[model samples]
Target: MDSDELSEKQNRGVAARIREELARRRVSRQYLADLAKISLSTLEKALSGHRPFTLATTIRLEEALAMRLRVSETLDNVAAISNGHADEQFGAYSRASVAWIEGLYLTVRPSFGDRQAIFAYCTEIHWNEAASNLRFNEKDRLDAAFTQQGTVSIPNLSGHIYLSTNTSGQQRLIIVSRPSITGEMYGILTTLQAGRGAQLTPVAAPIVLIPMKALADAPLGRINPDQPGFDAYAAYLKRTVEEPFAMFLPGVAAP
Candidate 1:
């Protein structure tokens, strides 16, 4: 069908869902109309299938009625199925099970050069595979496995350990060690500058990945993981439209 027809049908569906939710919650139609800043008559017509909707109007309805419309798949599928453009998926897609670490965080060490390190101060920890198992004299020790390869290209990783590439092609991994809040903003902001329409999101608790091109756009600064608001980077990730994936690791917990 035509775009207008599809949009009209979707609007009707949205209106119906909103009315159903309001009725289920015992909220009056007039109350909803007032909260939505729309006239009761307009609300009635939309709900009764007599009026079309604009994108802004639909968002308003959601805000006023507190109802979420299942439109992502509908829109995504329509574009792909109708236009033969299968690469138009929006939002985050999970490729592999994302792993999480509680106390560990990500920070970019640009000065560290093409090599990134995963440091831990623990008394003892075992390696995943052929990697070395070494005891550290201090609280901070870099995972020599990641450094062995020198600037490994990874889709996702945990605490100085790099994982396989993102077969899903929806994400790219970035490693950052001991970054400040402002430093993170700089990183993401720099990435945004390079990425433009691209977005950012955190797969693990502290590790954030963006389109590889965004790296040039990210700002520079030292980040401290021990301070408050360090996790704010995750919130920033959630604000964007990108695929987010995480895997469960041995010592890490999912947030």
Candidate 2:
């Protein structure tokens, strides 16, 4: 086949696979478009064969669906689109360089509703062969449905790491200092606070990601003051403020 014909065939194959995923997942095209951060019109045109899918759009769709759409030439190349190096989108880190971070973490942060309670969960960070970047997923949550999974950004200039989730354009961010000698990361988490039915307010709190191995006996999920491990978990969280990992500025009130 000619180059143009081959490209056209690939586009049609991608469109078909995307349609299959949409149907299998029972998700709407509008939802997919929104999650992929693409305009509905653009998605519709590409899926309907009115326009070809651009590489950027295809990558976005793959990320949204958490699946590969392109048929690579070889399995090795297919394993990493960047040949084991993450693209600029994820700080261009290589898989080998970030190998040390591939492990489970006990993620701790303050409860949005309870001032004295600390919320604890499991966050697994590992390399994604398909995307060639470190990805993180949250588990062991009291509310599993709201658990997040997204790419990890390790920028060298700032000497900080970021765990961010972007769902339908709403973003949640956790900016943390690099791992200490004990592999603990202290930082600040900014996310939407769910209020009474459909109400969400912006909220920020100190957050910590401790290597699960370091606290194998620690408890998970809603560590209240009455809980056994609450003191230890609270201590780890306090370091976020005491060590001054992040600062919250209270703006000047009206005089």
Candidate 3:
């Protein structure tokens, strides 16, 4: 085919992949647009075949989805490199072995901004074929701009699951126990808390992950004390401490 025809075909392929991902993840187009830092109209036009996706827009979408849409000659080699590194780092667990953990969870934690409120969001865990490991992404967050996506590590020896994000040198971590009989995971989350005047403070808080399927028609986002499910959500977060899923140590003077 001619160059224009090849480009058009490629655009159609990328658009199809994007649509598939949106359906698979059950994410709204507006959410994807926000995550990709693109205007909704632009994404709509591109998806509708009225406008071709620019290289920059395609890259942004790929990063937002944490998956590749465009085919590259070196794609296999890149996947092999990622798989090799991830296998060693994430305990080499095969997709079948960790299949049970691949689903949506209602992630709950103490709100950083409100002492008496709980922040709720949706988290999706799925196997990354290219990376040969499990991956996770947080969505439906009130603070959507700060949403996180990262690799999941499940080490057999520790018997704990870790969701960690590393950008540049900064890192955010969540360590949770294995799923309970009811499919709830309790844990602690460690990340930088934004303070006044561009200041950031190191902070950690208890967190809980409940299977989305278990919470039928429950509200997400921020749950305050007066909210309907606040009490239950608070109880789940408290499990991270009461069950002793994680411990907090006070600082001691150097010896």
Residues 57-138, candidate 1: write the lDDT tens digits: 6666655533334354354333343242111121121212121221222333222221222121111111111111110111
User: Which is the better candidate, 1 or 3, if ranked by TM-score?
Assistant: 3
TM-score of predicted model 3? Answer: 0.73
Whole-model lDDT, candidate 3? 0.83
Per-residue lDDT, model 2, residue 148, is 76
The order by descending lDDT is 3, 2, 1
Q: Residue 69 in model 3: shift from native, Å?
A: 8.1
Cα lDDT of all candidates, in order?
0.35, 0.81, 0.83
Candidate 3 per-residue C-alpha lDDT over 55-173 given as tens digits, one digit per residue, 9 for 90 to 100: 87887887777666675533544355554345767877767778999999999999999999999999999876544578898878899778888789998899999998865447899
Worst ten-residue run, lDDT, model 1? 129-138
**For model 3, what is the error of residue 106's alpha carbon versus the real structure, in angstroms, after optimal superposition?**
0.7
Error of 1 at 38 (Å): 0.9
Clashing pairs in 2: none
Error of 1 at 1 (Å): 12
The TM-score of predicted model 1 comes to: 0.28
